[model samples]
Target chain A: MLERVRIVLVNTSLPANIGAAARAMKTMGLAQMVLVAPKIFPSPEADTLSSGATDILAQARVVSSLDEAIAGCRLVIGTSARSRHIPWPLLNPRAAAAQAWAELPVGEVALVFGREDRGLTNDELHKCHYHVHIPTNPDFSSLNLAAAVQVLAYEMRMRSLEDDQVEAPFWGVDWDIDAAPAEDIERLFVHLEQVLVKVDFLDPENPRQLMTRLRRLFLRSRLDTVELNVLRGFLTAIEKSSKQ
Target chain B: MLERVRIVLVNTSLPANIGAAARAMKTMGLAQMVLVAPKIFPSPEADTLSSGATDILAQARVVSSLDEAIAGCRLVIGTSARSRHIPWPLLNPRAAAAQAWAELPVGEVALVFGREDRGLTNDELHKCHYHVHIPTNPDFSSLNLAAAVQVLAYEMRMRSLEDDQVEAPFWGVDWDIDAAPAEDIERLFVHLEQVLVKVDFLDPENPRQLMTRLRRLFLRSRLDTVELNVLRGFLTAIEKSSKQ
Candidate 1:
């Protein structure tokens, strides 16, 4: 499954970043790499930048377009630094990696990295099933292209190993049942937030961090279908009773 | 809590690696990086490699010894790839990030990364309360120092984001109990290992992974002081019954 993971670099500006990305991929045991219309490749700069992992750079396929880069991939994910005006389906790097690896047994998965100056265009992102956001500091969020690849590659590689049991995040709440799908969770959040605002518990004008914290708390709970439904039903009752 | 997490680099050889590491740190929102006797600093190579993260390089403190680098930190973790002759408490990068963040409220925490050639020495590892091993390819386990930092720094910073709620790991046992101190946990491991060996449950001659897995399980449980004592008491009883 890990071997089926392809790291695609689109219109990369720096040759060194291309080399570094190859090195990062090799170190994590990923072999497949594809480049789409890079400014310069097959250069000494890339070889020097590859450190000891130049073989990955050598085997890397150079394509003319992003479509060709991900033509055979069953799962296509683009790395995006900024949010769009209308949000697309987004996955944090961890989730995206998990989702990609889960699809790997069926077919190839492409993790697309955009150009250095600007990330993937909206049209390019629209082609992807998900956008992976590598959470960075708001103040200095200009993550080097290879550094971003290093993170996602590391996550994907780690998931293949049994060590993920140790790296799991602390969700605070544990559910014995299967977790609800992301769409169901989103619907629950919207339903609950609407009721809270209706009951004056949340201020729509100046919501501040109430909704954010509530999202964190509920997300941390990892609610199952029954639990989510129960919570939503309780919120509805509160909305009706509060009118009295 | 973010401000309290310190990044300590031990005896780095390459100036470029340091610069790359500084850039990696800044991108992940980590500000504090302490170097213990670096070979070169303030070099043009480091400056060039830092790519726009030179401010972090300018502010990084170079210390004479590892002890001095982490003097004020109450929690110290070292990054190691291979197992020592006798294993120390260890965590995968993700768990170490969560654990370090959890300790931030208590006091300053240190995340130590060693040289590109050789990782932390036994003496240096002794100063650390835990070791964080970033899983890499077994055939080519040689991870570049800056790349390793980027992975860990990314993990630590990502945990601070609200996305942790979705990526949380399973702790297995859930008890609303205070987590025991690292030192107390260390002591418990020592006491438990002695009894396990004395009772022949764990053979000292060929210890294998018995103790290593035990440490991982206990650490994952995040036992409190009372729980540690109760487990120790059970060990003592087992030893007594084995004698009979």
Candidate 2:
């Protein structure tokens, strides 16, 4: 996943900021940097600002345009401080990373950052499928170019590190055991509803509101198979007691 | 909350970075700046780099030691890339901000960032009650001192802006209505144990084991008054049933 991420800087003004961006990217485990018509590349100022991240700049790919920069990438995310006039699906940095991670196949995923002064032009922004906005103070939303890259890269790296398999510990056992699948849980809900109606705990007529509320409560609990069985057992006991 | 945050730079080498730090703080609504053993103060480079934030530097306090800088602050958060031997409570930026917001008084909340090369010494880290480690790439963790300050300041500002009175809504109306005062909650736990014994859920003989498990479960739930009332009511019902 890390290898697939390609960070592209578009028309960067300051060489120092470009260097800092590379440093930021490297710090967050992101190596691939593509500069689009930087004002001054391979400058001493850039090397000085990059500190230990000179290797990233040494290996960086230089391009002319945004289109040329992200040509091969399957997933393209444009970074923006403010919303544009044209409609584009907007996502926060974390959500954008999640979207990118989900969609990224064998192809590269390009995370495009705009210029230091006036961000990406609408034409450049239009080329990307989604725009990511870092939430900031309304009064002073001036995030440095490198800081912007750092935030996005950090989110992507953190998400990548999360375990793919969803397993939680419960009662000194992995909750995956005896876990009723989703279909089973849905079937049990139907069964419980039938029993509730028979017991008159749920009104058969005009039951929509009450049933919805009950469903929401159960959904919020996120019960696995063992927990579902425990709940069903309790409901069964209640049903028997009602009959008695 | 913003007023309470004191931004402390320890052994800062560059005057320009100090200026940048001031600008970053001001942008994030953090006012106080404390410098500890800086190489140069009142340097022209600092004023030049400060941009429009020179006022923050002008008002900044210079202290002889890190200890002196944070003497008044109850919550001291040290920022570092590396982990320390003393094992101060390690927190991510958000968690550290939450802890600071909750624990620190309205007077001073110290956020300490170390030198550019080697970060805070183990002894310096020990002085802080909590350590905030910005999630950076392990391979190259060389974040600019000012950038590090900016990230933490931004997080703190964003968190502080969230509606202070609004309890997380998931806890529901019962939480709002029948919520126990902190003192009442503590008392209720003691009373609950006494009732547990009467109900024989707590064994009169060989009591420690069952009581420990029950206590653990109750603590995990963090029962408010509404929850406490529900449990107590159920226990009363059981006692009545036993009597019958």
Candidate 3:
């Protein structure tokens, strides 16, 4: 079950921290690791820090972009530093782990971590279905990279260790049907943006925050594969009507 | 309430580990630290590793022994590696934090950690009224000293941040009364041991596990001050009856 969950590091700075993150993940029985444009990889520093868990580093997949990292993942949860601006479905680490576990049976799930210095960009954050914030001392919220991973990974491990109690269905009765993967969601957003611009509801000259808000609303609902197709068809009908 | 909680490290070998532990504690809103017979202190290495949490390292109280470190604490919880031989009331980190929170209002509480390499000594482990074990991958359970501190401290902080929903009382309706402090509990044990030896119930030549089992039973109950007095009186009565 844990094998299907991937830890995605986006633009991580220090190689040692990457190794440390791998070690943290391994300690919690998580093996899958995906590095998105890491500053350096396969470095001796990372190897040294990973200690005996070098197998995680050896097996870690390196990707050129976050898109490639979370490509087929149906549920992508980004780690965000507490920010009031990103009014998305924000969850604490424990709740996030529960959500991840709930989705794990459906398809691949990704727990995405940001750069060591600045966390996920607003654009990158928008790509995620949910954001998880590790609540820390407000005065000293500078959580070390691996520490954040450790906390989240620990929560994930805890969730896995729990008895096979029924997890509250994330999407009610329709949960058995797979949720649309990231790429499908991305295409939907792009098509929706184009239709909005054509209909003159959204200004092409000044997009403003309308698309972002729309994305949040849709992401929060987590469109299933069938729902995605229906939405796509609806958008195609709108285009046909506009052409007529 | 968090202010009343102290993190005690016994016989820590590295100054850097101490510093990292301080950082972890500070991140989780814990301020007090007690170091028992550390190999090094007031070192730049500790300060460097502490990052911006130097204030915690600066204010940390260095004591000569574990007894001195936990001196007046009402509750002492030791972090232990899973050992089947140590048959005592062991709690996972989350449960330990809840227990700590339940006791925090009564008096000071201590969370004790042993050396980085060997963890708490059997003698040191006996000093704690309760033990907390963080579950890890059994194959690679080499949790870093600071990481262990981070997990426990994080749990403590989470407990503190929770709404003041009444904690499940550790001692029923008598919860309003003060629980016996560590020193008082220690005294009760001493008196009981003496009386047991006098009655030949406990062989003084080889005490074996009798005292340990008794400690576990009494510690699990968490005697209130009044109960402590009652137990002490009962022990005295036993001694008098034995002498007659």
TM-score of each: 0.67, 0.63, 0.66
Model 3 lDDT on a 0 to 1 scale: 0.78
Model 2, B38-112: lDDT tens digits are 999978899877666778899999999986888656457789665653344567776666666664433357899
Task: For candidate 1, give the lDDT of residue B229.
Answer: 85
lDDT of 3 by residue, B1-244 (tens): 7778899998889898898888888888889999998999989999988878999998999989887787666567799987835354577888788877876765577899988889998667755656788878888877778888899998888888777322222222136565454446666777888888788898988977677666656654646778889988888777777753
What DockQ does predicted model 3 obtain? 0.08
Off by over 4 Å in 3: A164-244, B164-244
Q: Per the 3 Å backbone cut-off, how many clashing residue pairs does candidate 2 have?
A: 2
Model 2 misplaced regions, further than 4 Å: A104-107, A162-244, B104-107, B161-244
Backbone clash count, each prediction separately = 3, 2, 0
Which interface RMSD does candidate 3 score? 27.1
lDDT-best of 2 and 3: 3
Candidate 1's residue-wise lDDT over B1-244, tens digit each?
5767889999999999999988888888888989999998879999988878888899999999986887766567799876776565678888888877876765677899888888998767755666788888886676779999999999888788854546523231243554454445556778888888887788788977676566546654546668888998898888778863
lDDT tens digits, residues A5-51, model 3? 89999999999889888888888888999999999998999998887
Ranking by TM-score: 1, 3, 2
Candidate 1: residue A126 Cα off by (Å):
1.8
Best by TM-score: 1
Lowest summed lDDT across 10 adjacent residues in model 3 chain A is found at A164-173
Candidate 1, overall lDDT?
0.78
Estimate the lDDT of model 2. Answer: 0.71
